[model samples]
Target: MVAGPKVVHQSMPVLDVQYRCVAKGIEETVDISAAAAAVAVVTPPSSPSFRPASELDLRESDAISDVALDVNVLPFVPSIRSGSYSDIGPRRYMEDEHICIDDLSTHMGSLFKCPTPSAFYGVFDGHGGPDAAAYLRRHVMRFFFEDTDFPQSLQVDDVFLEDVENSVRKAYLLADHALADECTVNKSSGTTVLTTLVFGRLLLVANAGDCRAVLCRKGEAVDMSQDHRPIYAAERQRVVESGGFIDDGYLNGVLSVSRALGDWDLKLPRGSPSPLIAEPEFRQALLTEEDEFLIIGCDGIWDVMSSQHAVSIVRKGLRRHDDPQQCARELVMEALRLNTFDNLTVIVICFSNEQQDSSPSQQQPPVLRCCSLSAEALCNLRRWLDDDRSN
Candidate 1:
């Protein structure tokens, strides 16, 4: 079994007393005290309930032999194709940003050695302002691949997974630090991040906020990451232990999420333990034929719909059109119809070469035809009409 990444707490210096905030290209000096007092009131969404995989019934024929399940055998591999859509739903400005790279190795070229058939995707949901999210989006590749020591291994083994996890954790922390160092981003602004990395059949997800990743496995919704909110028991305990309190489901009575990148005002005095940390929780899965696609979205979508509900919609869309981009658009429109109160962003990543239309096709109704009368019948009808007219 591969061990998870070990977290180390490091203190960071608090920002200066006055914070300069940049929103929509306007710069305004914000007092830290005032910023802390003004908290956005957002209704927390219900936590997702997922059934354990063991509880799912599997047919004997679907089971793989031990020999085929071996890592060296490579029984199944995913052909990834992705598309995304975003809308500033009900919000004055869009604060969500995302990235979808279908081919990572080819994109990176000779910058660093990467496994074949690699891809990367991420969603950043910002609060307080859009600066944090925008900054991360601009520098995400550098932070993950260039700044941090990302592991270079051709093999997908337990050791490689451990190394990748460590590297990704470091990258998250590095981004957090970079946000603080950036003079343009506001100290109070922060963004929740969820990222997915795919190397051949291995899928790894690292999340630090409410943004979620859901996998469609044989038409069932499998949650790939957990939402880190103050209402969650584990997160609540951690916040309290770090000298923070949750007020009305808000962490520290200010932020909605328990973990995020940036938000220097909440995390600083440069490394005493802070309630709002940049550490990301990791989840991994070995993909198989049953795994069809993945849905990564901001809280806007999840707030209005369940994971299974989103999966069903996307599955139906794929069956009808097999267009991931259209599926993403449908998701956003559905969220709007459901009246989500925040910005919306969604990414649909398909694993199969083509849409799998498993449902039986409906037969078209038979056509009805009109028949013409014969010449003798027409003459008889004409004579009857003439006799009626004469009478």
Candidate 2:
């Protein structure tokens, strides 16, 4: 007789057999397969959780994605009824400014199978020049993606939020330095940076200068980005402290806008309360099914159209089965219709394809949606630097 514990149980799946074995072995070795035939318990089946129905395009995506813009000529601007401006002004006679887009993603979580497609669509309305917007086009989106914690879990509290905010601030400052190094001809180059990024379910929107981002949630208009206008209370105070007086009719004695890039002429004094800064105001929002499309455009659009009016037209256009490109095109067309007389650009981003019934309400009157800044317009901004470049 052998002295040892009994082999109490065995479980088998496919080729493998597992058992609760206690060694009670004598010198005689028996076939182990028979030992596996002990008590085998069958576990009850359970259903797997179902995933949502919305489908994602699975084809491999490029780091920089390009979609052609629908170029339309506005023969008569007044015919477009969606916005306040009636004339887009003179037709341009120059080389077409190239508009390109690039995105980088982070895979920081289990659900992060692919790089979070941080999509960016900006409408830079270049006035003094395209350098500002062009600078942004080259660096802003990439800057945000670089060194960022991808798919960062929201469970992190204030500490994480602070880190994120600091990251963005550093990115902006880096862009400023990078611009100084890259472009010599356009030292005064500046552009309004209005960027919207979608990573998983989080939406981060950042802006500097007059460009704006408006979010349409549940058929209601929401301001996602704050316009850094000269008249904003904080901006006004900053201006006063900088010895820059807001002229009776303007943001300040010199510049019409309170906040901007490439206006190195407006930096604050050594001991000024609010330092001369071009840092972007940042906002983070959790995106849900209710969040519709996002509209980000230069001041040209926001100048002529109110946030609510822009939302209405975009919502209606979407209801008409307008794609993101179409909605963006229509928004630009509307701004031109209002006679904005400035560089016009619009980027409309549809978050999801799910549709819903319109809320019962009277259509509000058309407001304004003018915008400005362009990557190609930087050529003109170089001249401004020669005129102003204070240390």
Candidate 3:
């Protein structure tokens, strides 16, 4: 076992005080605060309700015959107070990639022809190999900003919104096309991308494959993106329409996701076009005072935790440690604790709200617990099931 370098903890920043409503019902209005105590985000819980893995979606992965947890991922909870902040925690995937591109303070935004100096966050979960995910992470921002009609600045007009959407669409497609064109990249390698762009209070989330984005508006969990899995109704319909078969929920008996970047090798269609596509779907939101934090994670985390469950964990982490970075690390650790079989990566972005006081007292956070099957046993079961089906 090798020791990994220590992670530098965040020195809690003195956040500029902002306003948050004391009122409970914001169903009538959109503007709100991110502070957990000030606003009634979700039916002001009597006690923080943190459920385990059984309540949310779960996907069984190949069981591990040899499982060893890395010690480098030191377990620590950290936060960045005041303003917008982000953190990442990686767990056991050889191919998962996360990028935080914040150019707000630099002239890079203008140089890239972007309209705003907003930060970009992406989590790419790679399959087959790391090439596809790594490629997209390196070039996502370039494609997003270099394209024609990218936003110059914030415009209230609907036309500009359309243009921004178009730019994102073009960027995603271009990235996909680029992967297909790259001779060195393995055509068999593919990746699931979940990217979030923050412009002031507006959040534009683009998604492909199963990586998920969830916004903790107040205390309530709000889904910012949808998973594109092979078994999904719409996804299945499209696969069939494109002359693809889903053998045991696998796309054409090969991939599990219906949409992703790369997979040129799987583009071989019996009669129709390729079953896999790189086009991403978009979701937009206007952040308010009540929007506490947003989470972008690979399927490994979501497989064992619900949107609300993940939010509950982050909110509790913030209340106790007040650190988004630590909160992210905790999330990955929690998933690992639950015995997840896939790679894990989770990002938590907190929006700073107007604080009521200079030094806020730390609050006691709720406790949580979960269960999981050993990787070896699960893998054995999966193989047995597969053999049974095949025979």
What is the model-wide C-alpha lDDT for candidate 2?
A: 0.52
Off by over 4 Å in 3: 1-93, 103-107, 111-117, 268-272, 353-391
- Across 1-391, the per-residue lDDT of candidate 2 in tens digits comes to 0111222222243324222211232112212233222212322224353222122111222112323332453221110011111123344621112232323233223443332444434444443456655666655556654644432443434565566577667766666556555644265455556655554455677777777888888878889888776778898887777666777635445555665555443443322333335687888777665677677776767778899898898888777754566776777788778876566666666765423232224232221111121212212222232243442
Please write out the lDDT profile of model 1 over residues 1-391, one tens digit for every residue.
Answer: 0111222212232323333333344333333322222222223234454333223222333222323222444367788999899999999989999999999998888776767689999999999899999999999999999788789988899999999999999999999999989999999889999999999999999999999999999899999999999999999999999999999999888888999999999988877899999999999999988888999999999999999999999999888877899999999999999999999999999988443323234322221111222233233334443465699
Candidate 3, residue 212: Cα displacement in angstroms equals 0.2
- Enumerate residue pairs that collide in model 1: 10-271, 11-270, 11-271, 12-270, 12-271, 13-270
The lDDT of each candidate is 0.81, 0.52, 0.67
Ranked by lDDT, the better of candidates 1 and 2 is 1
Stretches of candidate 1 off by over 4 Å are: 1-74, 356-391
Ranking by TM-score: 1, 3, 2
Q: Pick the candidate with the highest TM-score.
A: 1
Candidate 2: worst-modelled 10 consecutive residues by lDDT = 76-85
| TM-score to native of every candidate shown | 0.73, 0.58, 0.66
What stretches of model 2 exceed 4 Å from their correct place? 1-118, 121-123, 147-161, 180-185, 248-252, 268-276, 354-391
